[model samples]
Target: MPRRRPNGVGLEVSALGLGCMGMSQTYGVPDDRESIATIHRALERGCFFFDTAESYGPFVNEELLGRALRGRREEAVIATKFGWEYEGTRRGALNSKPEHIRRVVDECLGRLKTDRIDVLYQHRVDLEVPIEEVAGAVGELIQAGKVLHFGLSEAGAGTIARAHEVCPVALLQTEYSLWERHIEQEILPAIRERGIGLVAYSPLGRGFLTSTALPAEEYPESDYRRHDPRFQGDNFTANTAAASVVREVAARREVTPAQIALAWLLHRGEDIVPIPGTKRRVTLEENLAAVDVVLDAEDLRRLDEALPPEAVAGTRYPEAVMHMNGR
Candidate 1:
């Protein structure tokens, strides 16, 4: 397995990480047996970094990851987030109050069946709570040895600086792919300046770049992508066409479009890690193999021209959800 140290933190992880969110909710139904098998496959293949969040499945995703890592926890680098409030399975509101952060960490530790979280992130910028306070709360956890590293998701450049000042942030989890390049203009530079690494989620454009994306209407209402503007109506058609460049490159290189997309992110820098979510062992193997798909300068140029920021169709999220990003 290829190993990478984000921001020179001396914390080494597999070049490709496993995103465990899909196993419990979103995209489709839950399949415990398949998901556990997939996790075992990932470990066998040397892909150990696993990401989940409290809001995912409103709680079940952590439990699922906990169960999967049961006897073999020592071999994995677990990363999970907390920032949202939940009423059973339904999401309620954003809550990152200092007290809430402390309480959530305990609950997450319990759910994950681990004494420490390898990396703990604030899922989103809690506008209700100041970034420094959130950082301080996480800092205390780090001091207490409950979390090994701290991360932020979808935070602005200024917010990242503030949080890092309070507690050195090890990574920033956000959306980045051939179709989404908003961070390149500002956030990327800021993190690079501070020597912080990036954890690129939705690295496959939510599976759209893989040429297997279904139209929004095809998804059940229970699926979160149904409400995502990028998957709806004309936007889906336009985005699919725009992402064809990935397929073109894949055909030329004799690799899957998903591999092409992941390879593009991997080539961006050693500090950047892409966590592509999958519940099937076959897809997991395919995603992990992307580390070997080398895209030369010409291939990189073609991909850049193919999916420029303007080429994408809709906002990454609906209004309410979009409001929470880059805060």
Candidate 2:
């Protein structure tokens, strides 16, 4: 695998980072043995950028990464986040207090078994706490050598500018792919103008681009897609039809639809790094192979036209939690 730096920051990682959320929860049941093996395989294959969050499993995900990177910590660039206030073991509400940010970094270090975090993201902007304070807190951590870089996830363009004024934001982690182009409207311009790198999560459209997705109701309640509007009824049918464009190109290139989808993201720009999450080594290998897939001018044009922003049917998240994004 090759390497790509998301921004001008000193933090350069694998061209394709591995999203570790699925190993802990969201996608399917926990498979510790296979998940750990996949992590090891990722390192062996030179895909060393690993993404996890403290909010994921509320803490267990960081512990799992810590366990996986015990002896090979030096080979990986670890990125974890903190954003929610917890009630015992359950998440209660959004929290980004300066004191809480400091506390979370220390706790993350303990769980990740590292001296410092490579990139620390707010996860979501806390409306109660100003972003400057949030950036200031992380900036302090950076000065104290507890964090290497500052980042924000799903933040609005204005918030990005405000936070960058307080502390240089090296990266912005958000859901971006052929299917999710909402950020391109304003966030992309803001990030580029500020020289911040982009880490695109769900570059596969939550597995819809894999050509193997089921209806929303088919997924268990534990799975996030079961609630994703794009996976429901008429939306699912229409979205699936639109995705046929990916399959057509894949078949023409003699590759998988996933490979075609990921290749297009890679061609989109050098500043963009898509962290497609998978818990299985087989799937991991398939995704990493996408780095080698080439998309010509024709392929890019067709793909760009296939899933126009208007073509995508439901909102990425449910209305209940939609308020949490782009704050």
Candidate 3:
């Protein structure tokens, strides 16, 4: 038999979902052929949910997913995000305007090769636009059979409440991990209360907690990890120390550091699902096996003490990216 279904609001996904961001951009140049193969591999392994964003590779990622899911669409659950507004020359910034939302969903459907999005998330909270307007737009898509579920990314508790009033949010995607526990204070409570599934992105702490990621200088020039404070300067040294603690626990348990990081999140909540990004088969396998590494109460407490919420040094994103979150 397969693993138990992880419930997310009204939808059900495999216990583990694949994060398709790395297959498009972020880490380095990605080979489309290899990325497609990886997506197929995930399906073969029984992973039903795949995540991609319009902002990833600036629309190129959705196209990539479209190709990968072409004839095999029914084998997976496809989730794509919108909300970034891009004019001809300039890159995209967030725009959840009702008109723009309609426009972008058409474009995303064209790129995704699908009639309806399985789960549609607003890439970020657009403060200038009312949450009700955004919810109203997605709600219309649901009624029109263009969208199955609505979601939000990095939205605060207040915005989530307001949006839920308009249309029940199916999921809330945010950066939550052992190193980054800010969501635990308010976001998790709100989500649990409202029965919204929490999709934890960057759940491996952008590979910092995985221990396989080396120094910033060792990363490729195109890699975005270089821009993260935890991967730069003295912060890298401090961050490595935190990984060392995880490594120690993993060694004793005979598991990889990546598994330890992911397993911790699994123990966090049944409603919480982690999407750890990886480009290679080896890393992907390492991540998938995390579901089997059950962490007992003692294990959870020790791991928490080893890397406390306040212990992670520096911010997860740069100043500009940081400003974009939690609106």
Candidate 4:
């Protein structure tokens, strides 16, 4: 797979990074041994960056990645987030206190079987903790040789500016796809000016863009999609309709809808690196192949016209989950 330089970060990662969230949580049950194999396969295929979060399996995903990268740690760029403090199954909260960041870095270091995190993101903007303080904490980690770079996830423009003032941000990971374009208004321009990269999560819209979303009643009760507004009632119907348009285009082009979506993101900007999640090798390879799909200006214009930002009928997350995002 061919790769491109993203700004001045000086780090070269695969065009499409693998999102490990589904291997441990969100999507469904997963085979640990198989997931590890999948990680190995991804590395063999040139995928150097792996994305995970503290909230993903609350910790399981990190441990899994740690084991998989035990000996090959130096070959991969590991990225994970901190800031969410889950008290119990029913109670979850955000905490980005400087002390909390120090503690989590120590924990992540142990769980990842590495001395330093290549990219340490503040999972989400912790409104309770000043952005300056958050950046300062990561800056200390950098000085201590515990973290190489700092990034933010789902942060607003104001928060990003404040955080960068404390420590230069190398990247900002957030939800951006054909269906989600809120970042285009402010986030993209801010990061572009600062020479920071954008790590796009859910570029496939949680499988909606791939034309595989289950019906409203088919999703498991514990499944996150069950509560997502886009997956419920009429919203899901409307969402599926838009997805069908992409499917039609893919069929006409002799490619998969998933490929079309990922390829579109690739053309969006060289600074954009999308991490599409999957637990099975079949789907993982399918997504990796997206790097080969070529799209022209006309294709992108058609996609942009068909699925405008906010074309999806409902919010990306349900109220409860939405509250936990972007702090």
Q: What is the Å distance of residue 9 in model 1 from its true position?
A: 2.2
Give me the runs in candidate 4 sitting further than 4 Å from their true place: 87-91, 321-327
- Top lDDT prediction, candidate number: 2
Global lDDT of model 2:
0.93
TM-score of each: 0.98, 0.99, 0.96, 0.96
For model 4, residues 30-140, the per-residue Cα lDDT tens digits are 789889988998898898789987778878889999999989998898999997776663326678999999998998989888998988999877788899999999999
Clashing pairs in model 3? none
How do the residues 118-177 of candidate 2 rate in per-residue lDDT, one tens digit apiece? Answer: 999999989999999999999999999989999899999999999999999999999998
Note the residue pairs that clash in candidate 2.
Answer: 6-197
Cα miss at 6, model 1 (Å)?
1.1
For model 3, residues 134-247, the per-residue Cα lDDT tens digits are: 999999999999999999999999999999999989999999888898888898898888889888999988888876777788898788888888888788888888768788
- The model with the greatest TM-score is 2
Report the poorest 10 consecutive residues by lDDT, candidate 4: 84-93
Clashes of each: 0, 1, 0, 0
State the C-alpha lDDT per candidate: 0.92, 0.93, 0.85, 0.85
Report the C-alpha displacement of residue 9, candidate 4, in angstroms: 2.7
TM for candidate 1 is: 0.98
Q: Please give the lDDT score for candidate 4.
A: 0.85
TM-score of 2: 0.99
